[model samples]
Target: MKLLVVEDEKKLLENVAAFLERKGFLVDTAQDAEDGLDLALERNYDCIILDVILPGMGGYEFCRFLREEIGSDVPIIIITALGEIDSRIEGLKIGADDYLPKPFDLRELEARVRALIRRNQLRSEPVIRYGPLTYDSRSGVFSCSKKELSLTSRESSILELFLRNPGTVFSREEITDKIWETGFESRSNIVDVYIRYIRRKLEAAGILDIIQTVPRKGYGLRRLRDDG
Candidate 1:
């Protein structure tokens, strides 16, 4: 899972980021609300840990902008020192899914994050089907021809992207940005390497022509026939 932590306290930010990273989550941190807003707008995240007290744009305003302006349904958890009823009400009224007060337990925070993600996943389409292949979002399982395809995390992420947007060509840069949250190295061949891995697995499963290379452009999923 991916998360964005927006906290002004440098030590707290680093601690939270490090803790979450150790928990196997791809975490990005912002010292202030502006940077957090920018990151939230630019990338996709399973959940956002927003600080209510910020330098310029406060968490309440940011949450409102994220929900009202950007129309993002990504779950948001507002963290604040103010734990009063009114404060919690304001956070929820503005569109935060959950609220955590200052000096909260990391384990509880992690549990809340997982619960929100699970609820969101339940609301979304769990399985995406293209021909005989199926991508199960809940389990991170990809299967073809009734056989489960063993995929590394990167391979599964790329395949899920293609399956979700069939026929839309994705440039290597786009893939790298989405898959590798941190920017890719200029000389990195990771994208091509993973594409080859996915293709090999698909071929082995008797699935063909699903992922197509657009000449000098990028890669895309071929439109599957209704009967395919």
Candidate 2:
């Protein structure tokens, strides 16, 4: 599993990364929240280990920004010096999966990392099987019961995002952020055209039609069997 360790303490950060790497995990480290957020946004990670005492953007604000602004559901584990009951409660309240205080044992942290990754994988499977359609993320392949259908890069990204957050509304801005990184030229019809591309590809595959528009909200993925 891949994990991102965001901590300002150089020694603790390296130790955590080395320990997790030894435990058979793909580990990445960032010294502050800005770098951490950039990594999280650019690539997918199984879980993020965020330190509370960051230099630029504090961990509390970073967690909230990720949830409310980015619309990411990646599991988060907060590391903090404060072990008070209230502090843990606050971290959980802000959408952190687990918390490890400063001066923690490596073994305990490893266990928590394993648990979080297990839960995260359960939540974000690469290939989703729905009825006769299959969405394969690893190969960027999609298929129906009979034939394979090719998808454009943007189409694949949108479809993958929808499957991960099925039944959840995604704002237009959120979709833009996921697909187009910073400095990409923006156009009005990009999303609409991409939606059309996804529709046409699914239609060609003879897959069940389940993608839907939420009027003013944005695009959402509806499972063929779970249409409401």
Clashes in predicted model 2: 0
Model 1 steric clash pairs: none
TM-score of each: 0.60, 0.55
Candidates in order have lDDT scores of: 0.86, 0.81
The alpha-carbon deviation from the true structure for residue 11 of candidate 2, after best TM-score superposition, in angstroms, is 0.5
What TM-score does candidate 1 reach? 0.60
lDDT of 1 by residue, 189-228 (tens): 7788889999999999999878999987788798877753
